[model samples]
Target: MAVVVALGAFLMTLFGGWVAQRVIDRRHLVLGLAGGLMLGVVGLDLLPEALSAAGDDLFGVPEALLLFVGGFLFAHAVERLLAVRRAAHGAADWGAEPGGPAKGKERVPQVGLTAAAAMVGHSLMDGIALGAAFQVGGGMGATVALAVITHDFADGFNTYTITSLYGNDRRKALGMLVADALAPLVGAASTLLFTLPEELLGGYLGFFGGVLLYLAAAEILPEAHHDHPALSTLLCTVAGVGFIWCVVGISGG
Candidate 1:
């Protein structure tokens, strides 16, 4: 059942990348909605479950929260390293010529590949979460699956966009997109081989919540608003949150 639910996410991922290739005008709206859905999942679903599962405190703070902070900082540090690497390579590729277009096109593919790869890792974790949730209970599993399915569209969109934006060839970007789509299925199946401790599962859920929050705020929303601050895009974000809320309500009941 968990694998079946994960398939929905896989299909949504493909659809998202396909839409990205075909549609240019409403890209911002799509991104806004994706960001909102991620935010909703973290706030409305993952956090509460993590807190419930992670009982007691660690160093006077919730263990799950500590893990959350760690996840956020870890992602930040990795992104910083990637940025520094990109800049150094950019300088090397283009030389120190002023007014040059920074013809660092060769370096761009590496940056895109790195970012997309990270997203694929994240998607795999999402699958793990789905399988682990089912271990806890069916209702919990369904809720997590729903969240994963919706957020996956954003994952695929970002994977393709990041790859292409960084000068990766269309073929390479599409290849990464396909890999991202398949990652969750692999993750879910892996869970059938081993079980995670409840506390550990909570920690992972909290950590992933932080990851989703960071991606939504740092990557998706900023890009959504960068060029297109249209009212419709903003509305789409709100609608995305509302949609998740409705889904959660229905699934929970």
Candidate 2:
């Protein structure tokens, strides 16, 4: 049943990537909504659940919060390392000529590959969340599944856009998009093999919440607002959050 539900997410991800390929005009709007949806999930779903499930404190902080910080820093480190590597490689290729047009554009794919890989990892975790939630209760599982399914569209869109934006070939970007789409299915299936402890699940949720929050605030939202900053885009973001709120409400009932 969980796998069946994840199939919906898989389709949504493919649709998102297709939309990204076809629609350039509404990029900001799409990104805005995606960012908003991510924010809503972290705040309204993941964090609360993590807090409730986390069992104890670590160094006077909740274990979930500690994992949250760890996740944030972990993502920050990954980005920084990728940036440094890109800079060094770019400079080497350009021969230290100040502002010389970067010669080895091919190397730029590394950045996108890294980012897309992270998104794929997150999607897998989303599947695990679905399975774990079902183990707890049907209502909880369905709610988590709804959030994961909705957020996955953004995952697919960002996976393609980030890969292409970083100079990867269309084929590579599409490949990653397909992998991201399939990851949840794998994760959901894995749940049948094993279950995580509640405390550990809380920690994982906190960690992933931080990851999604960072991506939404630090990456996606900024990119969305970078060019247009129009009222319509802002409204799209608001509507995205409102949509999630309704989903949460309905699922809770």
Candidate 3:
């Protein structure tokens, strides 16, 4: 049953990616909406759930919160390391120019791919959660499925947008989108073999939430406004957040 429901998620994800592909010309709006959706998922959905599930506190800080901070720092560090490496390689290849390599352009594709990979992992977990919920009861399963299906559009959209925004080729973006689309099904099937611990799940969610937040705040949102700087782009972002909020509220109710 879980697997069957996951099929819906798959289709929705593909549809979302298709939408992103269609809007390539309006890159700013696509990015704005994606950024807003990421912010909403991290703040309104993932963090709250992580806090609820991982109830352990260490030195007056929730373990999930600690992991969240760690994930953010880790993402930042990885991007910087990749940037430095690219800079060095470019200098070696092109003969040490006065200004060095174009760090901004060179490092973007890596970051996009990394961020898209994280989204894939998140989708995998979503499927696992869907399957686990069904194990408990159909009611629980349906509710979880609803949440997963709803947000997965955003997932698909972001996966494609992020991959392409950073200068990755269309084929690579589509590949990531397909992977994202399939993740939930794979995750749901895995649940038949074993269940994940709630604490572990919480920790993972918290960490991923942080990674996503950093992408939205530090990468996606800035990129959205960098060229366009239009009111419509900002509104699209707000609409994205509102859309997620509504999804969460509905799921909770």
How far in Å is the alpha carbon of 137 misplaced in model 1?
2.6
Q: Is candidate 1 or candidate 2 better by lDDT?
A: 1
Alpha-carbon deviation at 92 in model 3, angstroms: 24
Q: How well does model 2 score by local distance difference test?
A: 0.78
Q: Cα lDDT of model 1 overall?
A: 0.79
Backbone-clash count (model 2): 0
Tens-digit lDDT string for candidate 2 (1-253): 7899999989988988998789866878877887777777778777888888995998889999888878888877776766623432343346557565556455567877887887798789889878887776676677667668877887787788777767789999999999999999999999999878888888887887887787777767776786689988888888877877787787783
- The RMSD (Cα, Å) of candidate 1 is 4.2
Kindly report which residue pairs in candidate 2 clash with one another: none
Cα RMSD, each candidate = 4.2, 4.6, 6.5
TM-score for each of the candidates:
0.85, 0.81, 0.63
Q: Write the per-residue lDDT of candidate 1 for residues 185-222, one digit (tens) a residue.
A: 99898899988888888988888778778877777787
Model 1 ranges off by over 4 Å: 84-100, 103-106
lDDT for each residue of candidate 3 in 1-253, tens digit (9 for 90 to 100):
9999999999989988998768645867877887777777678777787787788999999999999998888767765754522322242344446564564345567877887887798789778877876764564466557557766876787788678766789999999999999999999999889765888878766776776677677766776786689999999889978877887787672
Q: Judging by lDDT, tell me the better candidate of 2 and 3.
A: 2
RMSD value for candidate 2: 4.6
C-alpha lDDT of all candidate models, in order: 0.79, 0.78, 0.76
